[model samples]
Target: MINDKVLSIILGGGQGSRLYPLTEARSKPAVPIAGKYRLVDIPISNCINSDIKRMFVLTQFNSASLNKHISNTFHFSFFSSAFVDVLAAEQTISSDKWFQGTADAVRQSMHHFLAHDFEYALILSGDQLYQMDFNQMIKKHEEANAEISIATYPVNAKDATSFGILKTNEENVITSFIEKPKADLLPDWTSEVSEEMKGEGRNYLASMGIYIFNRDLLIKLMDNPDTVDFGKEIIPQSIHEHKTVSFQYEGYWTDIGNIDSFFEANLGLTDDIPKFNLYDQKQRIYTHARILPTSKISGTTLNKAVIGDGCIIHAAKIERSVIGIRSRIGKESVVINTYMMGSDNYESLAEIDKKKINILMGIGERCHIKNAIIDRNCRIGDDVKINGGKHLEDKETDTYCIKEGIVVIKKGAVIPKGTII
Candidate 1:
């Protein structure tokens, strides 16, 4: 068991521009995932499982939703030393500007870190999905007696260009680090191995953006003028100065920054032997369990789907999809390869087309939705057809065309029924 002398700082400030309609009203961390839980829940759950109770979530863009979610979901006893809080942007003695980068965000929140007496600071991204025993990483950091420890993973060289790759010796001491190196510059890890082991391989370890920094060392590094980001600036610069170590993680970790990646991550949940299992009794992934009854999936043919609690699926053909909590799918609706969230109700008489539907939903019983992302609480009218094949210019709304031609119904907007787009 690891001691509780570490503070986990979650970076939840990204704009999540890639998510578009889903992120328009909320920060990236606040965005819903796996139908029931939000993206930020993953890291928080990991912290709880790892027995690290003292945590802070830093936020900036569309932080209201993120703040509200954190407040409602994470409510630990204040009498105890353990607590979780959301730290928003504030005017500091140093600057009044918004966070310039990941390092800058931590630099601005330095006062919070200084107030607490912690030995190490574990910085994590709020948008990634993974199941990790950070206690192991912490123990490694302590054993290595290093100023910094980063969680690294081996990926193929072709995919290495998208990550901050690192070079380390047999002792796991990082010698060099590069961000998104070209294919030609990528190192062949198998080259050093014997000919018997020198088959076709593209294994190169890359940083997973999960860092455990010695408290004093982190403060000193942040004080430097050149340190801008942990990946782009800090780690690369520190390799020449500090004893930064790398901890290899063979477990599952995914960055859900884009739509395709987000879709794939959700699909992973349905796997029989999924890498990230939320249902493990020993390592239960904790979320704010809704006080609702089990899903009422009557008259629905659900195949290879993940249905959350309190969902009422009536006469709907939901195949290979994920339905969130308290969402009602009405009669004769066909939902395929899609994800639907809570606080939504489909009309009983609505006929939904499966092939054209992506992330579509209705706000309430009378709302009609198709081939579009209806934001939270959007009251779409009955018989409303948001039909425009995957890439139509919406100059009127000043929104870029979706590749799949998805029509987005903004949250809380009352779209009249029978209205065709």
Candidate 2:
């Protein structure tokens, strides 16, 4: 039913500094999510469900893992013209600089758009988790026949200052936009909605950072040497001169930019009425389904938790936590409200004694830990108690300090036996 040719370009190149230890080795987009899936899976799955097959993932910072994951998980047949490809920074005829911003990333990958002969370019962030029928947005874009179309969502006025808010006219035409406005300077939007909806008290419609651009306009905008970014520069300029339409989106959308948000987003999955459904049969979430055996949960006391495949919960007490694939919980070990990721060959053994049972907690096999986030592939010896979360001090470190006074282990770090960090 849609006629406009669209090319989906995902900006997956951010360093994700906000996620620190998790982003130490892997790119933000490649960071694991919901115990089994990666951050990029959210946007890719959204595109798949929306029937947008052609995709180009732009990567720069620590892209090897991301590229491998994309190649292994997303595969298209030769018969199909649509394909998903990873676009890395390369020496081009124009310039030899790395991507400076979102617009610059697109500008660098102009060749991909030119090759596809797309009429519209759909730009999205790879780190956001949401479910949207972009085809519907594309249809609305075509109906409006505007130079640009942005997906907008209503946020409380109190939270509006955190996002790029836009003011639209009665015809859904964007009149102005402000990025992270002060509370006192926030624009009012009561006139745009119906009288009954006015009492909502001027809710600000903020940009979800999802954009649909006329391919020609995008090319023109990118060609302008002065334009640096879509939100910071190009969008503001467009609203001033060009006709831009706003497509209001009413759905679950969350940008998992930090550890707290990431943890909260993962916890959102276990809700009785989850906002994001990974098990939608009609809109299946495609991943590299590991060829591991079913999980063996014997004599385990799990309460309100999520356990992955090939895991063995041997008489362990887990509550309100997410256990990664191939992880093993030793006998009588307690895990609560944590995110654990491990390989398929992970193993653990707990040592029990007459007086007090020694808990051998760790991420990978042979790694002993406790009250700490044992990074991937760490080796810990028996009788070692890593007090990663015990000492509660706001030391200048690049890791999340949980309110429970738990220490966070950075990725790819090693902890020696009997070491208490």
Candidate 3:
């Protein structure tokens, strides 16, 4: 059972340079996913589902959209003590600097966290996709009597090098921590683990970056002025001094750290049997419900596509795509293997015909966009082709960017007719 003694802190990331133009106008958590939900919604919804309602999201980057979305979406009943809040980085008398790193962000916001009456602090990442009942993790923390409990996932030898590896005692107390060790160094470290501990045929235990810390221990660890990052400086140092434990988790988890990962995750949602199920009624992901009309289409062929509300389509062929809200697809357009984030506002045909704006608000006629990401409020003219060549290259331009062969049209960009990539 969850009580009011726990406080959840979600680390909304910094400028999110890896996500780039998607993060151009908004923070990474504010970036839309699954067509309807923001990235921040995932962690917050998980907290609510776990009956852990006292939460704070810490962000220092472009936070306008993130703030607006959180304010509009989560509203607890007045009779309950549950609430979700945003703690943007501010310059106070005690600290004049911005958030230096993950731990530093928590350190700067420690004052806000201290004001609340909570015994345990749950730390989460804002840009991850997974559904976890943190109540179980809290229970494990209580059983182990641990000062710090890390949620870990098992990975095969091939993928273990990319993550921070863990070695634990028979009781699952973490004995050592290694961040992104080489492949050759991993076998020696993981070989020490017992077969019973290596469940699911995986040889290595990787840190999920989800942690449960005793409130006092978190404060004590953060008091160190030099510990800026948890994985790099704090956790590695605390393993010996603190009662740290590991909770092995078996579930689907993806970190949307870069463009390729983000693209693949969104596209993976359209699978016949998606690894991450958004349609799970028991643990539903919450978002701001936009009161818009149902999407309308005429003579269109859509295959395994997820379209959002208030979209108007005219004879377009869309396949394996996630179309966002307020999208308008013109006649004879074909969108395949793309994540189309639709417009914020609607531009009627009359508005377009009157030349109120130079370009339309959505996809123009006779466009062929494949394996790309069309960001919010883009204006693609007719006869536009965005299919990159067979070979991948790291390319960038004023109107678009091609990272790992996935072309991304910039937000609110105006691409002229007859353009090709």
Candidate 4:
């Protein structure tokens, strides 16, 4: 069979301190991306598209929103075995501590996975942006008779420092591995990449942190509690003892590890043709099916902008931005190089007029926002100017925070009129 019965284990990352403010209220998997879908949707949708539907999302911190999103979005037929469940960390008699690392999280949740019948385990990272058909990777694994298969991507010397580097033999069997090799060692780490990649100076094969492990081997490895992380400890130790294969993926895959990379990845969608293809019909990025009206715009000149459903945009000019669902941009406001995560729900005009609302849930009139991320349900008063750049120091307040020169207005924050950042 081309596609076999497989289980997917999505590792919801730790506290997510790097993507803070966006991850302040929710877990990493639940953080909204590309205007609509959550980060977890990338892996789950890939599994669904590949006909491997049974999946579990492992998370520990702030999983309320994640739980809500999963429940509200995915619905499988009762007659079928397909399921998408969110598994949060729980205290058991054997171990009571929280998830220490990636491997430990799966080790704790192995009992749940054992109940399902599967020959292979497809493990994925929660915070990543890509569209892939995992069936191809599985086919390579089964054909190679491999105990482990890792999805590897060719990255340059500068990008190699951030990812785990892998070395494969002539037959594409992984011979050695190194975690975040320094730039000085990159000269010796160059591998055989495609000519296109060679021209781009991307020679080192970096682990994409996407792995496929045989069911029996995964069970055997889980017995040892010392191995905490797959990148730091597990893969490096197992490659020598077991047969491991490298599955090279030369596509638009990005690790949403920090604010700077996350910002760039979201804004990159505005390009003429984004590397991350969201419009692919076969490989769709699934998310919540919200009942929202069509977006309404008046006097807004949108250039290279992506607007989601049910938005009321009256901005004078919006250039190179992603306006999310149910967003409201006021008259004469200009938004550039920003990602505005739309509100969860709409505020009625009656409620606003009766109470004489001070600030509305969206960009206010005559505002200027550039190089910033306005989180969900933010209320910015009129005449607000937020220009995010390297000139400002990193700081955080009750309403908003600045990281890597990007101003992130906190969720549900209200900025007073005439405020300047």
Candidate 5:
């Protein structure tokens, strides 16, 4: 069981501008993944698997969908003290603006956290995909008597430029840090990981944006009104004054920051041996349990595809794709290398006929779509062709868009018949 000494705070990113259109309507964490689960489920499921009870998610942009998902999905028994609640950015007499940064977001919501009883405040990023047992990290924190402990993963020289890299002594005490440093600017000092980590070709310790701080030390750190971000301001300053240390995690961790990364991560799940496993019964990812019929397929061919529940596939060819719930594909259509976020509700035969449209809520017959993202509630007409590879740079229109060679049919978009791009 998770001890009462720890309380968790998940930082749902501000605005999520990097993950555009996907974050267009919902917050970053609320963006759905793996065909059924939202991005937030990764962190929350990790906490639940670790037996942690009390957790708060802080979000500032487009939080209505996120709030509704959390409220409808997670419910603790009346007898239990556990709760997963959202603390949105609100203006009070003391604070007038929205969350300026990660640190500021937590600082603004300190009142809600202070009301609860806990010793250490565990901070985590909501957009990351990974599974970890926090009890182990907390145990290390107490053993080292560290005022602050940051969870770290080793990264190679090529990938090191995109993360917050740090130098530590042999004892794992952090000495210096650099945020998104150039290769030449990296610190000379190097910390050693276990033999297991060395096998993975990891050379530098990259911060996972996960931290554990003593309750009092956290409040004191946030006391300064000027320090807004942790990686940019607070962490660099804390190395000298606080007993800061690193807890090494040599596991699969992916930061779903932008559209390219998000697309690749989702498609990676279709690999023969995926790095991140969603089938582990001991530590399974949880989400809203929607009641729907089993997926029905007739004369369809699928290869390396993960299809969700309540889908009707009719003589379609789907390869290397992740199809979401309530999806419908008509005869002879081909979907290749796509991430199809399916419809919210299924349309009946009567409703489909009444509309008299070429497509009804899903892909139409004889359509050829490749390397694209079909957002929810899309009506792709028959004979429509969308090839992200054709338009490599970027193009945006009311009907469709191409970002980084990935065609994104906007949410609720209606593509007419014989449309080609």
Candidate 6:
């Protein structure tokens, strides 16, 4: 099978400054999403469903938690070669610095990749939310005898400016490329999309930043030290010289590039029919198999809410929210439009009763939290009111950050009683 001859490299992006406190302790791929799963799970699960078992994730900053997560989550038969390995930026005899860019990361890690026997490399971004069958893309690449294949998505003109636009010929072969082209330049950059996409005013094809490179070609490109990025340096320079084709994909794909996008992606799971389907059994998202008790709720009126395992709730109402594992909400609390990442462990009731701990690791009584993200193991005191909206200005405190009206309580933060934001 072609899958056996394919290797996957998922790029865990740089410092992730846009994500702020969320990325402070972990790498971008290690950042949690949809309550239960990490950002890296999306790409790895896609490869698993496609039967591309052997994979490597490359990350540089704050990779300790990322490494630990992968080590604990993915396990295969002892006799099989299936494995997922993380390769952080390392100092070798040739280079002594961190990974400069996407291409440089691969270049620095080429020694490990070359040790494996593979004909093609399926490069993917770790921070994207999408499900795709990579087998079809590989098969198409073989049929076209293309040296490189890029996944493209049809987006509207308004969104085209934010992405690297590709111009393709009638054969679906890329002819030219422009990175974040101006609005006036979009008229010439439109590509052939399906009737459904055209009707949706999605005539422009945006590069999805997913690519497949023939092993030999990737090796050749990596040798050039000057070229340090795929989307900026490799794709544009190689399109006219190499047989590069575009694989147009029409699906629910969103890049978790910033706090706004990340927050929206999680809350979208609460929709009646979400664009990104998490309930599809055939294409299920894989994650750490934790042995946890079933979530328990009382006096909580849940409407369009997704509660994860091992939650103990007493909230008056939870609407349009995602409550994560081991979450605990107190009486009369009203939580709306929020993503509450649950605690890592239940605080010993004995400790709380003994007053050994002042505030417990959960929301307190009579608190009203809206449009906020309470990260893992946060402690909220009683009678607190946090109303996050566009009316709030962007600011950062020791325990929380306000960005675009979303109040993100940092992990392990302690909020005093009778507080308001």
Highest-scoring model, lDDT = 6
RMSD of 3: 2.0
Clashing pairs in 4: none
Q: Which segments of candidate 5 are over 4 A away from where they belong?
A: 187-189, 353-358
- lDDT for residue 44 in candidate 4, whole number 0-100: 89
lDDT of 5: 0.90
C-alpha lDDT score of every prediction, in listed order:
0.74, 0.73, 0.89, 0.93, 0.90, 0.94
**Better candidate number, 2 or 5, judged by lDDT:** 5
Q: TM-scores across all candidates? A: 0.86, 0.87, 0.95, 0.98, 0.97, 0.99
Flag regions of model 3 displaced more than 4 Å: 191-201, 353-355, 389-392
Superior by lDDT: candidate 2 or candidate 6: 6
- C-alpha-based local distance difference test score of model 2: 0.73
10 residues in a row with least lDDT, candidate 6: 1-10
Which residue pairs in candidate 5 collide?
A: none
What tens-digit string does per-residue lDDT give for candidate 2 at 153-238? 77777778888989999889999888998888874542264433346553678898999999888888888867768889999999
Query: Which residue pairs in candidate 6 collide?
Result: none
User: What value does the lDDT take at residue 272 in candidate 4?
Assistant: 96
lDDT of 3 at 261: 93
**Tens digits of per-residue lDDT for model 4, 93-211:** 99999999999999999999999889999999999998888989999998999999999999999999988999888888999898889889989888888899999999999999999
